[model samples]
Target: MDFREYQRRARETDQTPDTDGDGLIVPLLGMAGEVGTLLADYKKRLRDRDTYRLFKESIAEELGDILWYVANLATKLDLDLDDIAAFNLRKTRERWLHVGEKQGRLPFYLLFDEQFPPEEQLPRKFSVKFSQEKQGSGATVVLTWDGQTIGNRLTDNAYVDDGYRFHDVFHLSYAALLGWSPVTRKLMQRKRKSNPKVDEVEDGGRAGVTEEGISAYVFSYAKDHSFLRNVGALDYELLRTIKRLTASFEVNIRSPADWERAILAGYQVWRKMRESEGGTVHLDLVNRTIAYSSE
Candidate 1:
């Protein structure tokens, strides 16, 4: 039967549908128990090996119980199962599709500075040179573009050199992969001053700080995962947190797949830059890539 019909019939048997805090626990606990039971049944089948004669039917029965509890909980909360299923599919589709892997459709990319003058927009292509200098016991990264020094020298500022000094690569990746970076706008003098509201809200200090927060947040996650070395996919909840963080800005239009690419590419360049002590990072917006050049 269809999900809607099954949902409607499922609730008919839900005796505890009071919609109160305590009443909600019935279905919630039921779902958890059924999941546990399903796994336990599988364990028994594996233990019994070929002697597990009714394994298929037993597993199906447990799944039906789980589905009933899930439907009953949704009904209690006044939700439609079919709508929920559709929404979940949409979310997973957007999250799983790789940046360059779509078969027939190009991923949507938004460039917030499209209407602005050339100088006022991020350079479609440019190279930022990072030169590391020694300061007694610490190191500082001098950032330069077009033979002119841009931002101040960066140091880890931590008790140990944890590579936080290379975090700026994350911002550069956002500029290259997602075409949005408040920090880049401020550094390159590309803020949307022609529109005061956009300047204040989109390319302002708070937005720059928000970008930095994302860089720091993702860095922490990367550190525990070997700096994302040889990793293929990112944690879904981590990407969801980034969405909530940037929901107020234009960059929010970028999908989780875009953010994942940005984060991974940034870390890849950062690793090379760190190993080489310093290097020139090339950003190509037209191709959506960031590459490190030791030369």
Candidate 2:
């Protein structure tokens, strides 16, 4: 049966009244409670091997309860279950299929359709440099990219002794792909004044963090592809640090191959948003420049 038809029939069984704004609340609570019951059943199955006999049946029943609450909630929100399902599938397909096909290819080739240029063919080497200055009881760390000062962080003796560093070149590549550079951010800010909602749907709500996460994924891919080595010897901590920092974002970074797939996935997401919402930023790695456009 069609999902809409199922939703219609399901709505018929929703006897909850609209009184006291409890219609949504009822289903929301039901969903939470049903999920808890489902978890409990799984826990029991894990604890008791004999429970495996009934686990499938129990799971099916709990899932049905969860579906009922979901349908009810959709009804309360005036949303169609079929529409939600369709939208989710469309989003996933758009963001994965094309990019997934490009796995195993060099990132520059996958992203810009150009071969990975030899080091001598490139204009200049990319590097993130750091300097330290002694303060009262500590030192302030200053970071620079291509001789342009970028950021500063105050650090204690121990922190400086640790020789920690931040990698920005990989992130620059990601920012170039997603148009999340300082210039892009400024443009977005200006656009927000005229159309506040533009920023809401574009850039995934947190462009900086999103770029960092994608960049980390690409860094992993680059490392395995030998792109990092091609450029120069890199600090072993670069990928480790990026992975640690972006872990909070819940990005999947299982293996080198997975990271390449993830980069494509991330590119598709930002590309779709840009195509629909109207903004463009292209990175010219050779010239080390970013060109921006907006509609």
Candidate 3:
């Protein structure tokens, strides 16, 4: 059955209050609780080998509960499950494919080079502002850069309240310093103009994986630096969440003296993956050139 049909059936059985005005709280809490239960089931199986026989069924039940809550939450928020799934897949495909196909491998040295102009040459110190503004029936986080409105989204309030908003800013700093943004932008433009389908699948996939690697680097840096205590917004939960997400990857940010090194590590991750797929990318930032080859 499709997501829309599942959502429709799930709503019929939902016993939660229809107009109690709990907003996103009920489903949010329910989802969290279900996830905890799912984890606990795995923990039990790990501790006792005899439980292996029941593991599959037990896990399936927990997943169903999780799905029910997720669907209900989407319904309450007026979001379609199919749309969410499609958007997520599209976004992931676009990001990773594009970067890998068009700009997978680069001059290794460029990743280490510091491309950020000196402070004297900088237009202004990098800064961001976060605030809440009424959006629809609830409030959303409004993000601004250099006193100009950039964008806003209905993010988990916990991110703002817990001071995890700096997470993206950290990644942004790395991108600017290493000049990856310009390179990625140019690659994207060229690929999109040449063939939109190729851009979406291959180019986008490369960009997606590159971003994941960058996130891994940023998390490693934050973990080593105590989440940059000087910022005074360090949230242990946020740090833990990031660590858990990137734990599967072996990548780590190695250069403490230069942030550019960390950014390069992120790029190397995508390049390595592309290499395994028989793709090669050679980039020269100074010369403003890119070459792609498939073996």
CA-lDDT, candidates in order: 0.88, 0.49, 0.49
Question: What TM-score, computed on C-alpha atoms, does each candidate reach?
Answer: 0.92, 0.45, 0.39
Model 1: ten consecutive residues of lowest lDDT: 99-108
lDDT of 3 at 39: 89
Q: What is the lDDT of residue 181 in candidate 3?
A: 37
Better lDDT candidate (1, 3): 1
lDDT of 3: 0.49
lDDT of 1: 0.88
Q: What TM-score would you give candidate 2 relative to the actual structure?
A: 0.45
Judge candidate 3 at residue 85 and give its lDDT: 90
> How far off is residue 73 in model 2, in Å?
1.4
Q: lDDT tens digits, residues 1-295, model 3?
A: 9999999999998777463467467777888998898888888888987957888898899899889989988898788999999987864443233332246442333432233323212222243344545555444555454456554353434523322322333333444443333223332232233446534543355554655455655555555654443342333344344444434322123122223333343334333322343233334344323333342
Query: Candidate 1, residues 132-169: lDDT per residue as tens digits?
Result: 99899989988888888887789997998987877788
lDDT of 2 by residue, 190-226 (tens): 2233334433433234645565454555545554654
